[model samples]
Target: MEKSGENYKVISCGDVASLGRVVLHDALALTGAEVSINELPAGVSVPFVHAHKNNEEVYVVLSGKGFLFIDGEEFAIQEGDAFRIDPKGERCMKADDTSAIRFICVQAKANSLEGFTQSDGVLSETKPSWL
Candidate 1:
């Protein structure tokens, strides 16, 4: 499901607990980043390791247990764990044999962030509707 207005859009990604990946770039008409919600069942690993040519990736584990293999090093990951990988870092993920894993991966051009919330946000005279 989706809804849109002049400058905002919202989409519902029902039941991320299931196994699969849902890419939101095209769905949300994203211009600067690609985001995906992914789920892997127990004892499964991505078929191949991969690295991006220009974009770095950040992964936020939403549930369960997993391991991230990056540049031949393995790191344990579980709910609330987040990590960033450089553009050229070889990476793959596997869910532990005991449970499924779900995560959100966000990719954007490496070194492209010049300003974040504190520096970029501007106070507005307009108040939020609920206020």
Candidate 2:
């Protein structure tokens, strides 16, 4: 059974995997959505290079430099770069031999606009309490 509570999920990239690359799945709890962090070693590319049938994705580059392939086209990416991919677009990425790549990938059903907007978020006054 699940209960309401406040918790923190602290993780380190090395903790997820020690291989040349790693994909940390469901790093955070998000309803109707998915989040993952990918760490790619130099010159290594993601294994999955296919398109999704129903979900679109956003890639946020956290560190290093790399190249992204979308729909058979290539684009250079770097730290602080963010881009979206349509569900029907084929995608993959590779890190440069000089630097590794760390990025976050968010995925959600394309039709669920409301879900992407965080409409379910609640704003409430904090309960009266003394520290």
Clashes of each: 0, 0
User: What residue runs in model 1 are displaced by over 4 Å at the alpha carbon?
Assistant: none
Query: Model 2, 1-131: lDDT tens per residue?
Result: 23335764455556433554444454445666677777788888888898999999998999999999999899899999999999999998999888888888888889777642367677667765872
On TM-score, the candidate that comes out on top is: 1
> In terms of lDDT, which candidate is strongest?
1
TM-scores for all candidates: the values are 0.94, 0.75
**Cand. 2 Cα-lDDT:** 0.79
**Model 1: ten consecutive residues of lowest lDDT:** 12-21
Model 1 superposed RMSD (Cα) = 1.2
Tell me the TM-score of model 2: 0.75
Residue-level error in angstroms, candidate 2, position 75: 1.5
